[model samples]
Target: MSEENTPPLPGYEGMPLAMLRHRIRSLGEEDLHRLMAYEREHAARTGVLEVLTARLDAVRQGAEPSEGDQGFQPEAAPPPAGGSPVGPASAAPASNPPPHGDPAQPARPKGDHRPGGGTRGGR
Candidate 1:
């Protein structure tokens, strides 16, 4: 479709399905038709088509355009104006395992120091 035939809502193509549904409430029947046509000609997504079709049907059955501007999308607000607050001072200390096996169970010394100090075969 030509640029003139674009969907009435700004950033319509990029809008999430939920956002599109809410935003389309402010559109009249004519605007919804344009949007539905544009959507069918382009993406033709199932969910988007369902939303448009349902809204169009509602409008045809005397559902008036809802209050508030379609362009007023508070959900699409700009990102906060600064880097993350994380810093070295706020970070947790590094962790290192004990050099001698596990801390819970220390490694045994060199040779076996058995009770009677006898060799394997009772030598």
Candidate 2:
């Protein structure tokens, strides 16, 4: 998954999402459909193929017979307690911060500067 596409997680949510996908691919269709239902009812992972899996099952099965299996209603994701990290969140944290106190960094400091003071343009 692209870094941009990966949702920010406080912890291990990212890995299971990715692993669920890998398992889906490995399982091919049947197992994928079962997992799709589980994921829909649980995480409601926002992936194209994952979402499609549930729909495909619905179409293939013909008439869900009830809304419970049609697809999942989105639920609020919970805070993770513990697990090994993975995905975008698993990457290293920022090592280098800009050496400027002012966060905006609007312009370069002018030359011919006095102690702790500088004009709009260097004199």
Candidate 3:
């Protein structure tokens, strides 16, 4: 079947249902809390929302280690014995993000070779 023809992801079921599933699947525990807050405020679904909300609460209370917080890292580490970044700050967003080349920095001009800092030398 064509990609377009394929049924949409489960969350497409409805805002309350589909978003809850997608949020639960894709988001970290902290993010799930944020989603749960929004879910409770608007478009709340008792059954589906409860499942996700329970998960959010479970994470908060340390009732159990979360689904896969087991080994995920800020930058995914090579998997090891212990799980996700541990301790109080692990769930918080990174303050300094991993580097990306700065788009604002000007690019070096192409084929503009020079000697002694300019085109001073004779050919």
Candidate 4:
């Protein structure tokens, strides 16, 4: 289809995919069919096809259009082992190292006595 004639993506033109899928449930059967045909003719992505097909099928099965939050809900990341949750007062004391070592200050072996390895300028 020509650029001007092609339909806009389900939600606002630049909306994220998760939001688009949620909003797609609100489209009428005719709108969904139009979008499916457009997608099949243009991008033809399997994920997009699956969502469109499922929503269309639901419409055919007499399901009412969804009106609530059906979009993705991200789970909170688990706290690091021996590390505290992030907050304003979670900073470690200056004298002690954090449970996880800091990358800014690398560790070196104590009392190093390696033979003739102090300076790199000598042959």
Among these predicted structures, which one has the highest TM-score? Answer: 1
Cα-based lDDT at residue 27, candidate 3:
52
- In order, the Cα lDDT scores of the candidates are 0.84, 0.47, 0.53, 0.67
Q: For each candidate, what TM-score against the reference?
A: 0.61, 0.26, 0.31, 0.45
Task: Count the clashes in each prediction.
Answer: 0, 0, 4, 0
TM-score-better candidate, 1 vs 3: 1
**Residue by residue across 14-108, what tens digits does model 2's lDDT show?**
34554333223323344445545554555676783454465466556662322232123134366788976687867888667667676576666
Candidate 1 runs further than 4 Å off:
1-3, 83-123
Give the candidate number with the greatest lDDT. Answer: 1
Model 1 poorest 10 in a row by lDDT: 112-121
lDDT of 1 at 19: 82
| Candidate 3, position 102, lDDT | 63
Where's the lowest-lDDT run of ten residues in candidate 3?
4-13
Pairwise lDDT winner, candidates 2 and 4 = 4
Model 2 spans > 4 angstroms off: 1-20, 48-123
As for candidate 4, its clashing pairs are none
Ten-residue region with minimum lDDT total, candidate 2: 64-73
RMSD to native, candidate 1: 5.1
Q: What is the C-alpha RMSD of each candidate to the true structure, in Å?
A: 5.1, 16.2, 19.9, 10.5
Model 1 earns a TM-score of: 0.61
